[model samples]
Target: MPRKKANETKTYVLDTNILLHEPLAFLSFQEHDVVVPMTVLEELDYIKDSKKDVARDARISIRSMEDVLHDATPEQMTEGVTLAGRGSGITAPSGKFSIFSDLELPEDHHVFTSNENDNRIINAALYLQEQKSPGQVVLVTKDINMRLKAKGAGLAHVEDYRTDQLISDIKYLSKGYHTFEGRFWERVKSVESRAEGRDTVHTIAKNILPEAYINEFILDESGEFAGLVESINEDSLEILDLGVERLMSRHAWGINPKNVPQAMALHALLDPHIDLVILTGPAGSGKTLLALAAALEMVVEKNMYDKIIVTRSTPEIAESIGFLPGTEEEKMAPWLAAITDSLEVLHKNDENVKGSMNYIMEKANIQFKSVNFMRGRSIQNAIVILDESQNLTASQLKTIITRCGEGTKLICSGNLAQIDSNYLSAVTSGLTYLVEKFKNFSGSATLNLDGVVRSRLADFAERHL
Candidate 1:
């Protein structure tokens, strides 16, 4: 596929994961000078030390340069790939993106490798800023907060690496159903009514938010209810009320009116056609439960969706694996345990379901695989639920979302403030990050899931904790 070129001419220095954003991300830098800091290379070396998955991801990133960069020979590469920056060249040129190697980490002199390495890489870009101070020395990073700290330190310009944003907010998305926005009430009155009676109520309901109910009539010029009733789900919204209705339809197991998240889930379930759906909320909220119900209704009851796939971010749980030594699955036991608890809650040890559950575990479903396994494959027709998505880097989220196949539905649910991903905060974590970006596209919907449907104790924790 021909890469869509960016018209901008800023100098974009990438943190390691930015290099990992699908092939097109790198190629998109057509006329720009892309910088790969030496510290990032050091970090990749350490990352590749973990598992075959990390090693494989590292290779994919390196291969992105196959069309443009070349290897530096002994005479040239004496300093390494960073210093001897020549890889196979095949790009439009005005001086290619420079690999600025030779930066130092004050701590290890080992040239920053971990988070320490990420800091040093941006430090190198700062050094570059001192040297060239170009139009905008933008450092594109998936490290949510790195961009912030970098800006605070001195890199004046920092932007998200999102070529595409995940559709998260319901109002903004190009829904399956067309909506008459409240914003249109003013203009539509000027231009004739773009939408008729029922649409007017849906539009007003969207404006009011939550469960929409109003006594006002949708009158024509003659001032009447227009001989039609404008009724919305006092508990749930009609599928036709969504900008993304084609993806959502009336399923036998409907979303509960009290469960506002259900209102959001229907959008995800209805859109079996949509491959990725990000649903986020705090603890005590029914993010996981709602997801399970949707999967059951679609896969078991309706036979629309294929399989139920569930995973979560392993950031906070990485330490547990350090104590248990074995294959990666054994290592990830603690993180994946949360999903198991949810599964247990769903099945409660039913023999008929146990077999399929065991298969999911052996095959990496229950205990089968980690997000690392999801990278290369195009997951299809399956309901992929990523709980606690807040702990993922934007790049990590991108990798997960792109892994979806033609008939897949990905549900990403997490509380923005509750993230464990290094350097990520409420605004920058993967959950909210995907939400803010893709809130306005076709076949995509995101629900912030405001109300806590769990017990009072759990709700109190999310509120105060």
Candidate 2:
């Protein structure tokens, strides 16, 4: 065993799940040494052949390892290989990467007989710590239980890999809307409005507006007189008037907005200029309903889109059903009950619309597709509604959003508080990521609905239980 020098870099032993979450996460560690345990490699080998996104990530990581260690000899691999200048589309890692296959734990060690992959990985980190200094070895994993085990095994360092985490605090995550009260409301009202093309723009002092992103909603304290921040200069802010009355009057397949957030959501959904709309809140907040209603309106009444493409992550439902039998749409039928429920609600509203649900489904040209098969396809002239988006990872969300082609608008709806993915949280959910990233984009809008309009029971449960 050797004592670590003051300038010696830390060694990070990565777990399989970290690489599966982000194949190129090693590049984020800067100059630290990254070690992959042999057990992790074996797990990745088993996973790489699957058709899931994790399998794709495993393959990408393995390929990246090959690209970096292309010319390295067997002896060189045991010692370590430089990962410098090998990263694609990102800054190269400036540290060494090595595979830790040799375990030298004591016979009486508590984890010696554990036989679990996590225990084996933790043993590797322990070996690294015993060979070097206590603080020199760290176990980096996404698994909370594994991290706890590492800490209990006398490991000095353990941390979650945070490469994909854009925001540290969930509260700081923008809701994409701000309300002004008292004198601030008066100042906003005083701002002169001028016609700019099809939009009415108002120029106000930057101090009055403080901080706002492009297309972000600005409402008065009474929830009336809403405007969208169109542009911002150093001293002045330009806001485009959001005609709430017009949005309220507009019906989408016989469904009109019931609240302020719903109205803003409708405005974003109906506006051709807004290519991406994100609706996030608790259950019964009308996220999916508003999105589906808007899709029906745009595709059926306005002929703005050729079809309505609906998809959602079905991890929970898939586990329950195990093996589903049918065509793609039929296989996705159970998971898309939300879509059917919304359609039924819409049908109940308008009896004059011939044939009700049948006519709406036929005339709207709706398609139920799986998110699993959405890769490598261009969705053109469609309103793509991605329901239950909180279940998707950031990478998966990126893949789904990039599938949008010309004349396509994407509506992403999810309740961050109700994330079904085991690996995701309110702060790390793809919905939160999109809301944070696209807030500044002029072509995107985000609406965080507050109240639950479904029923008193649902609202009470949401508040108390």
The TM-score of candidate 2 is 0.93
lDDT of each: 0.57, 0.82
Q: In candidate 2, how many Å is residue 249 off?
A: 3.4
Clashes of each: 28, 0
Work out how many backbone clashes candidate 2 has.
0
Alpha-carbon RMSD of each model: 9.5, 3.2
Question: Per-residue lDDT of 1-465 in model 2, one digit per residue for the tens?
Answer: 574463478888999988877888766776678888889889999989865557888999899877777888878776789876765454557678888884545665535476888888888888788787644888999788888888988888898877778899888888878887843456654577799788788898888867777888887766457788888888888987766676577667677888878888888888999999998889998998889988888888888899999999888447323378878888888899999988877777576544688777888888898888898999998999999999888888999999999989999999888877767788878788889889888899888888899999999999999
Global local distance difference test of model 1: 0.57
lDDT of 1 at 397: 82
